[model samples]
Target: MLNYEGIAASKGYAIANAYKLVHPNLSFSTMKIGNPSKQVKRLNNAIKRAVNDLNKIEEVVITNMGSASSEIFKLQATFISSPNFINEVSSVIIDSKVNAETAVSEILERRISKLKNAGNGKFVLDKIKDIDDIRKRLLAYLLNKNMSDLALIQSPVIVVSEDLTPNDIIQLSNKNVKGVIADLGTNTSHSAILTKSLNIPSIFGLNNISKNVSNDDLIIVNGMSGEVIVNPSNELVKEYSLKITKYNQTEKPLDKLKKRNAFTKDGKKIGINANISSPKEVNLIKNYMIDGIGLYRTEYLYIDSYSLPTEDEQFNVYKNILSSMNNKPVVIRTLDIGGDKQVPYLDNNDSSERNPFLGNRSIRFSLSKTIIFRTQIRALLRASIYGNLSIMFPMISELNEWYKVKKIINEEKRKLDDGGIAYKNPKLGIMVEVPSVAIMADQFAKNVDFMSIGTNDLIQYVMAADRGNPTVAALDNPLNPALLRMLERVVNVANAYKMDISLCGEMACNRYALPILIGMGFKNLSMNINSTLDVKALLSLLDYSLMQKMSEEIIKNACTVKDVIKIEQRFIKI
Candidate 1:
């Protein structure tokens, strides 16, 4: 047996022959020329076909996943049909005296170049991938060549690739895709996100898995542990095969937990909620016993479009989510942009700063750009009338930032009142992602209706390490003794103030952090939609008293992450 290690992107188990994902040769000479009118006609015809192809993929995503997952295709379709895009490509064909294929390639390259120079934010980086897909797809149509045929996949196989784009990942859905292993991807990569959303067993950043594998190589991918074994002997294959079977058996019973509320054996209950981006993501929780939408990232509403979403457009999306949940608690976070996200319209100068992550971002960016902030606040306020709503401000490091957001929200509410618009006063909250906020939780709790610990940022900020940087990624562990102590203090404050507090981050779904959270008095835990069931199932098997005991020991004796991990491992076995 040959073994390889990788970063786990999505969790499951698979044993199958490897099927390599390919990047088709769409390369063509830019000097190729044709009759000007003929080239323009071919360009128009290719655009129409590409749009049709996108629409079909969008349908597949919506049917198998949800409409939220299909937003990429919608954006593609909109861009392709836009007047500016059409004009630019057609002008290239006629003015440059080039073939339609060459014209499309040139325009796509120009767009990609523009995006590449748009600094390092995820918004620009994601668009680079989107435009790359468009370039290949359109050129293939013009040249009458085959693009990826993932949609036509017949048998179950583990997909190995140098890198899989979002467009490639989407079409592999409902097509017997056993697993996805990639040579390059991170936890936040679009391909990684898509695989997780589609519930496919996947691992990425395998270095050379794509190059080493052969046509007949049998692969066993354990997405849970990020392990891959190639050409294992009969005994080992049988062992791993049984593990997969047992894993499936265990998962089946977890689904039956849908209607059941999560509670400790001692009868203490905890709220299990989902972190979502778009409004249509509510559809993803229909089969699960989700307490509510804990973290509704409103950033996608702006990110999904070419221009800023108007007040009406934002309001409708918010309304749909609230109405769908039927008065269930929906905590809508106001545009948490400018950190890893950026847009050209929003004075993107800050995005070019030396340390953009520490620069203007989240609530900071919102306050600086009042129009964008107020527009979003007004829409969120209007949507409050539809169902239970809690509006949250993210990355508020100080009390002053908290006060500014509230003042602006009140100003918006007043304008709504003057306009005779019906709106509800939403329960206000702040994310405790900043160490400053976590330390001052007592004071912040006194002001806000609730608090949520955004551990994704909190850990990185507190540790002074970027999780994306491999050299310092180990520092991002939630098991760090100082973070646990800080969380204990925050949870204690919330309990003392009688305020609702929850954690909505990757930490919330992590098993190692589960006991510590509940033991520290957290009654609410919000994570990705698919993770709710696993957490809920584990919640039932735990005893609140034992968890509290274990937490007490770790808080006192665990001075390092290694100590905490050791304690957790020992307790997990018990």
Candidate 2:
């Protein structure tokens, strides 16, 4: 038996034969186009063929995985229509008189150049692997002239791959898919989140599972421990089965608390909110008495696309969430990209920086992509008609940036009015992530609807620690006194303005931070859906007034994580 360690993405246990997915060999060579007209025609023909293959893949996905998973084919379509991508490939293909695969390689090289210039060479390169895989599949389709057998399954499959794109992850049908293990992925990756949502076992960044493990090998995967047992004996399987049962049995109790309130023993109300990326998650809006969505990220619709989503597409997504809330407030935070999140369509060449977190990203990128920003505003405004929709601009530091956002929003409103589209005024807000913004929260509260503290970014920013960096992962402490003080300031300012204040970050989900947040006057606690009931139960068992009294000490003296935990333990006991 072989064992390896990786980050546990989704929790579960499973024993199944590994189904390893092999990627096609990628090749690239640049071509110089002598005739623009001829090159254009060739490029168009190639794209058409690629689209036809994607249609076949879509049909295959629908037949094999179900329609819900087939929505990912849209990503393949976007790749086919990439303007910079198409132009670059056409230039190389026509100039060099090479095969499409070689042309794609040259195009990839060009993308590497662009990525390097954008200052996130490694991040962009990782993302480009997905693009290249699509190109290779398209090449295979062209060579074979048939994708009919694409749905053929090899079953009782434990799907293993180097990684999974959001598009590929959906094509999985739970009927035959026992579990999934990958060589690369993060908690926020589409595959990881989807697996968690589906209650499947998943482990990521497991270095060499593909090379070490052969096909049809019986493997026992323990997601909680990030371990995969190769060729497990019957005894281990039986042991794991019991473990799974016990885990489920424990969780069976939390289900009943879903509908209940999160009021503490002293009757202090704790509002629960959910973090979301797509409008499809709107189904979760009324599952309980959720205060609202804390973070409705809009990046999913923009990233992996050749062109920005149409205004109608953006509006439909926003409107659905708005309509589903049924008078419940929804806070939609504008695009948060960079670090790991990237958009293929943006032609950013300034890649000289080291830390993308501190680079020209988030609101800075939003300002750069004016068309995208304007289109998003138009959709948010249209969706506002459905219910109470509050718009929050992310990564705000300087006050001037907020003014600029307000200016653009006003322009979008004017355009909507001119076009006779009905829209209610949305409560404008800002995400207090930067320390500067947190310190100046009182000033911002006067200009916006409410202040939503995004402690995840705030913690990273204040500590100068990259949360994704394993070397400094221990230093990524949201419990740091600096971050706590900022949260206190934000909550105080919001309360002074009679504005709603909430925390929607990884920190909000922390059992230790719960009392501190409640103590600091934060009414709403937005977190992952799975943790909602547990937090509610904990809240119901605690005394918020005591924590409120101790909030001052928690923020003033607590500099390390140990200090923060000690404070919470004492407050909770009281």
Which candidate tops lDDT? 1
Tens digits of lDDT, candidate 2, 302-374: 6634345777988888887877887787888887777656665464423645777788888988898787778
Candidate 1 per-residue lDDT, tens place, 395-467, comes to 9999998888888888888899999999988899999998999889889988999999988888888898764
What's model 2's TM-score?
0.78
Rate residue 204 of model 2 by lDDT.
Answer: 75
* Native-referenced Cα lDDT, model 1: 0.81
lDDT of each: 0.81, 0.72
Model 2 has an lDDT value of 0.72
Could you tell me which residue pairs clash in candidate 2?
A: 28-105, 31-92, 31-95, 31-96, 32-95, 69-170, 117-351, 118-351, 119-351
**TM-score on alpha carbons, each prediction:** 0.85, 0.78
